[model samples]
Target: MKKNSINRVIGFVIVGLVLLAAVIETGRSVYTWSQQAAKQPRYTIVIDPGHGGNDPGKIGINDVPEKDVNLAISLELKEILEQNDCRVVMTRQKDEALYQAGDTNKKVADLRARCQMINDSGADAVISIHQNSFTAESSRGAQVFYRASSQEGKKLADILQTQLVSGLDPDNRRVAKANSDYFMLKNTTATMVIVECGFLSNSKEAELLTQASYQRRVAWAVALGVLQYVSGGLS
Candidate 1:
């Protein structure tokens, strides 16, 4: 009897998520539909899905790997961006790491490779996706970070933050933050932002992050943000 009740409650949550996710996709469509082809954004974006292979990143509710969730959302974002006629580049498309064979320090090697790819690609911008986790389980919601000194990075981060808050979680009071100590931000020359998609440490948020529909919603929110940045639409 208890199991049945739990299942029913889960079903209701899923239904509600699907509806909100649909709104996410719709917002992207409406914006693109309203733009003229001559003015459509023609830019290349490098999407880095943080962690993979040996590095599972943060373990969340149900033991879901943050690496897998990151890749899923990134792939969705790539597709959405491409559908809007933007060129997309991915650091790693499969379940693998960017480190070379027999690399002594896998983490450093992987990051270097990702940075090289972004710098060499001449991409208009770069976005590294990762799941967040905090000791405090109550800390949730997505957050954006950019290099403190880069105006371009700040612009992208703020625009993306707005999209994330308004489109996915209006309750997320977090704003775009600037950091100067991050390796990825310092190494990559292009405009870039790191998006912590949500707090995996929060049980309720972890469950939501694991859902394919919710992942797509997060991707849509990001896609809309990227499009807006590339098109010079600040709002």
Candidate 2:
């Protein structure tokens, strides 16, 4: 073979080898990515924003509606959870009740519909958001409640309580409580929690809860708790 021809042949072989290696590497990368995706956690969560329409829950010091606050926080949490790859299902996305307009008993219909939605979702976790009230204005801080019979519920509640206290309300001394009598807790089949984000009766908390920034912060805390629970942090 001529010298120039031999050099050209060698270059061609080298180029072909490089291309082949690139193809193999690309395949390997794609396979690894698919495996990672398969292993990634896909948790389904049900977020229930308590009260709406005519049912303005627990009017606060400045007449801040608990229903509106719940919805706002739930929406923020849903957004964060979706971004983190969690499938979030919300009970009410707007300022409307779940019950039919002409229902004979609106409150009962609303509660039943919310419960049915939560049960049907087959969710890994269910969070019912609300604001608390007390006869005394000094009541504040967040509280988490779970079904008395469900171990999963307690675990979720504990994780959430810790997150809320640590991340949002550092001064919060409240802990998770078990309740078998609550309508949603007793009726819902999945692991469920009712998070009273704050005491709306307290003027300070009512003011904070009304602010969008504070609601966003509360959502972040709830999101962290949910991630920890589903990721087996407490397991």
Q: Give the top-scoring candidate (TM-score).
A: 2
lDDT tens per residue, model 1, 66-133? 99999999999999998996889999999888898999999999999999999999899899999999
Candidate 1 Cα misplacement greater than 4 A, ranges? 1-41
Q: After superposing candidate 2, which stretches have Cα over 4 Å from the reference?
A: 1-41
Candidate 2 lDDT (Cα, 0 to 1): 0.93
**What pairs collide in candidate 1?**
none
Clashing pairs in 2: none
Q: Residue 179 deviation, candidate 1, in Å?
A: 0.9
